[model samples]
Target: MPAAIALARQLSDADNKGIRLDSASLTEPGTPAEAFAVQRETLALNGWLTAGYKVAIRPDGSSVSAPMAHITHASTSGTAGFDRPAVDALEVEICFVLGKDLAPRNTPYTRETLLDHVAAIYSGVEFLGHRLDDGSRSPALLFLADRLGNAGYVLGEELPAKVTEPGQTYPLTITINGDAVFEGPGKHPNNDPVAAFLLFANALTEPVAKGRIITTGSLCGAIPTPPRAAIAISGFTTLTVTAASTRED
Candidate 1:
């Protein structure tokens, strides 16, 4: 895992210095397993606490995940405690909070059993950013190692009802700075809200304690956003972003 350690150091250093890495500078991992190794190292280097997880599955059935460090309430802190680089975009999503421990076991967790483990469903937003320059063209594995471009997660109000099954849809309207940026019905990218969660459940090597959150893939993809924007998503509480400042050195 030396490569993972080296890449993790580069990522952590870039974040500390408020700089973006050129893709060429990365000693990119060769496989998904190696990429996740880099993720573990990066989290260790940054001393970040794992509050939740975010995941997305690729078309090939392989998946990438990020351990979230910052989980905040939209009603109280908004994005004030987000400590990543500049905000790039916000992804509207559904967050499932665990009500029970899911430990590693021999048997797979079925969809029915998994839904029974959820404590609540809440409207959620994923703060997206990258340590790599423009991150779009960077290697997929590198992006995965960078915690799936997750800067933070903001928890909105709880839904009045529960989503007991997958493939549910919701009417979503996102307003930024009092202007409507996106308004439409939103569905999970994979068409199932629990698809990522299922993948996450089966892949865990450690126990996910009760109260840890699992945010599924973006419902409407990433919405380009500016710093310090007041964002309001229909059926959820409003959240304001903290202005991302750059170092002048």
Candidate 2:
């Protein structure tokens, strides 16, 4: 068994729960090939713990080479359920969904090939938790191990992940407490978030035999959650959400 899997089982046992990892650990690993190895082991562990998912982000926010990343567990929900009362996170992101469960990397890319997963795309939130004592601040593997660290999923029924054209631009707005946080025409994460998702997906190829979910990355800054706060996102037009905390929940 890989060290990450062993470590995950240990952690899971300790928490009596699933494991989730951070992206920082993979940025500059210590040992030779340590990063890639850790990710694989993490994926292996994820298969045992929960489902899988991905997050593709433009690290540069404007380049496809921004390194598409991934996380764990894909979820489907309606728009009404997006807020702190639903899950816990230091931040949230607005992402689109492809309607199909993708095949492995280098596979043929097409509008039709990516539409089978066919669920509506709505605004979902991802929670970035604080770091712990062991220098583990949610490694990438933990995200895989814990299934995209899925706290709660919120989606709109009218929107669809089914894309007929790759260039379709959707107007989106993400706001918190009435202040507009993110407003832009949502583009595919990598010209095709689905394809971008597949790139990272192929890297950790072990878990998909069962299935996986990809988040592609945040299109903008990660909103900081101060607890008992409100956050919301809308597609085509920016929808809003408000939250209140009693001295920070």
Candidate 3:
């Protein structure tokens, strides 16, 4: 097994108590498979609570290698802390709530069946481990064990649901401290992000509930959104969320 798993598990344990994990302990890294398993187990060890379903990571428009990217799993894990209802200086992003549980890969599913699980869609942000420079492994696996590297996801109201087709484009804009950092649409600089999500979403066996949101993935590679830094994922009428470091009361 990769040391990343053990370190991640241990770190995950500490984080659940509102303690942050240390990245330096991940000295002996493992393969993507190992890293992924550890992440799943870690989530189980802690408590997945009420969030699952994943978004796809498309090649950044500025990338040279078009990797066969995107991985899926339950969300809202990790050791990072943020405001629950909200923090003062939080990094916010838009998330999508799934209508139903998903079938595993290779299963036949249709737009109608998919929509039957109809639930309201909304947005939120996930604070996972960043700045660790654990950027050496495949994003799929690193994300797998880092407790999906997500923490304290928020959501939007369930009235005006966004029922996305398989190939539609999702426009995204991320801002920090009110300065626009990323602005784009589509996960595959070449393919559609909605298609990517559908591909994975359809594969899961169960449908997602009324409030489970998907952050999609980073429009920008990982960057730190600092104290009092507000991030807004500008899509679907724009979701305004924020994050900031606070002393535990």
TM-score on alpha carbons, each prediction: 0.89, 0.53, 0.59
Better of 1 and 2 by lDDT: 1
Candidate 2, residues 1-249: lDDT per residue as tens digits?
355555444433322232222334433334424433444454454353323344554354321211112232223333332332223342333344544454565654444445454344534445543222222235443433433333433332344444424555556666666676667665544555455544444444333422333455444435565555456666653333343222222
Q: Write the per-residue lDDT of candidate 1 for residues 171-236, one digit (tens) a residue.
A: 788887789888877777888878888887888788988998999887788887765567767743
lDDT score for residue 19 of model 3: 47
Candidate ranking (TM-score, best to worst):
1, 3, 2
lDDT of each: 0.76, 0.41, 0.45
Q: What's the lDDT for residue 151 in model 3?
A: 48
Tens digit per residue, CA lDDT, model 3, 145-199 = 5544454454533324442433445566777777887666524222333444555
Off by over 4 Å in 3: 1-5, 13-33, 48-50, 57-81, 84-94, 103-107, 135-140, 157-174, 182-191, 202-211, 218-223, 232-236, 246-249
The deviation in Å at residue 75 for candidate 3 is 21
Give the CA lDDT, 0 to 100, for residue 236 in model 3. 41
Give the poorly placed runs of model 2, Cα more than 4 Å off.
Answer: 9-49, 57-111, 116-122, 130-153, 158-170, 185-191, 200-212, 235-249
Best by TM-score: 1
